[model samples]
Target: MNSAEKIIDRFGGQSALAGLIGKRQSTVGYWAKKGTVPVSWHGKLLEIAKNQAIDLQPVDFIPIDDEKNLLPAESSLPKATHWGELTIGEKEIPCYVLNTGDRVFSLKGVVVGLMGTDGGQLVEYLKVRALQPHLPSDLLPAENGEIPALFKFDTGGEGFTKYAVGIKIERFNELLRAYSSALLDHHLSAHDSTKIALTDRQLQIATTAVRFLQASSDVGLVALVDEATGYQYERAEDALRIKLKLYLEEDMRKWEKTFPDPLWNEFGRLTNWKGSVHHRPKYWGKLVMELIYGYLDADVAKWLKENAPKPIRGQSYHQWLSGQYGLKKLTEHIWMVIGMASACQTMPELRQRMAERYGRTQVQMTLYLPVQH
Candidate 1:
């Protein structure tokens, strides 16, 4: 009998073969007509058929001659190793920017906490898009051009939004300043050497924000903050959203110069005395929170303790004091903000990104602090 006849005899023909393949007779006929298995997995299909205990048919047979006891030929096409291709919208530009000195951070806490997705998804995302060269080759310099930092994205969950971005940090010092400022902003305290009132949201964002502090030989503070916040913050004519950042040198200096300053002069310079103002800038909040609480918590704190006052502090000019400790709190809060800036590029990401990032550690300080008599 010919191959057709062999098929007919094997599994009692087309109808029986359909049951063996777990497909309709029509599908079997269609595959036969198509003259091949769906794609390159033809070997798997045949193995499955044999496993099902279906009587082998001549037509289903693959001619692998045992002449030299050789194995099947290997494939040339790239194997599907990673989680497939990373496709951002064609129109969407994946490139983000950072200044001279900026820090990179993690979004693990906020991303996993709020988004309900672990670092796996984020890792996959980074493997594809972020790992690729998004920045223009000419733009990246030979020596000090490429910014040192990390990038990430968060597709929000538990009532949150989705967004992505890249960030770069110059050194640990920059990270500390930003984190400290963020912490100060979050506590809603004006008792620093400098006196100022921060809005509730500002305080939250400043305190809890997570960030990455890229450690390297490079110097300069540059953070590339991006998100899906549209162009509202740019004051665009047709912007769909609006982002506002307030920079207050006067406020920073006033607080920094307050009596019994616990912060070093450089700390004061970094936080309060800077000539420029970056007081506040609106961003996609959801993404920001994720990056902060999710990503950079450990590094930021580690750097803070190292650079912040030592021997803790007690209470007077003769010894350690409240203002000094307050300075530490303020530093953490600001650092949180800097982290938030990297993570948060949109408003929705801001809400919880700020809350959780700040909320996590804020309770410890506020609740446990010794009251001044």
Candidate 2:
């Protein structure tokens, strides 16, 4: 077997390869990719041979000699050497280190910044927080009263050190639970036992569906942050805004394919087809949620009412959401509106808010605010 494959097999193959390399796994990975070990580690490999119960011979693996066939250049930027103090907005948060290069911080805002320190304090902080059940392995401490500190860690690779912290979305979770439960029961019943009239139930179902759709969009936004900022929520949001815009433009292509001439009458309701027997069915809820989640806030809705084509003035919320508003418009609106709401600032606060705001019903308002600056 090749040297990298041999080292890989020594730890029971690929499944356990990561554990064998310890904190320096990426370094070994780099060497393996290049098909050579640094000249300095050759003797150490031989010494480790006895303890690892593996044969070690210089000839067994290719010598570090060839330059022409070396792997693509990679940064030797030392793994983040320092983790600055845990700062959520303006506050210096209490944090714990989890390993040699993992740390946890607490935050609940959609906007956050990742700062580096001179030593490995971030990872040390994560280790400390991991000892407690309330803290997430990927969360840092935020609000003390509602959120009891959390844990989180960054998975570093691709030439950049990474960090991540999970912000609990209990309101969205409850919405999902309510949705799943309603679907299973085949009825829309609030926990408080309010007798929802038949028409009200239908409206509730549609509204909840739209909210969930928005939540799905929110998930995409978070993922965008993860990719762009690499353990920093602050940069992630900036990148997310850009990514969302691209997603909208792409979605427009899909819309053109799906509905070539989705006609709306003067009232903003689909009225271009005949009766049910010769009907052109419209997807109202899906379209509305996409708009509200993507761009149409209260003010935007008001502006549309004032300036939209006169025929569209009376259209419903769902009708408006599904129209031309895509990622670009939504990003613009989110940047403007996200700061208005004040809600939970940490995970525990999120859970608490969920119970207080939505415990008796299947729906509630959720605000995403950044850590206080």
Per-residue lDDT for 166-236 in model 2, tens only?
22344223333433443433343344353332244333443443444454476476676666876544343
lDDT of 1: 0.32
C-alpha lDDT values of all predictions: 0.32, 0.37
**For candidate 1, what is the TM-score?**
0.16
| lDDT (tens digit, per residue) of candidate 1 on 1-373 | 3323344345666687677667788866654554323322233444655886755421232122222322222222111111111111111111222132222222232223212332233333222221123223322223533333433322111122222333332322343345345454434444554334444543432332221112211111212221244323542231111010111000112222222322222222333344422232223233333433244333333333344332433334423322232233434554555555445544445445666754544343445777899
TM-score to native of every candidate shown = 0.16, 0.20
Query: Which candidate tops TM-score?
Result: 2
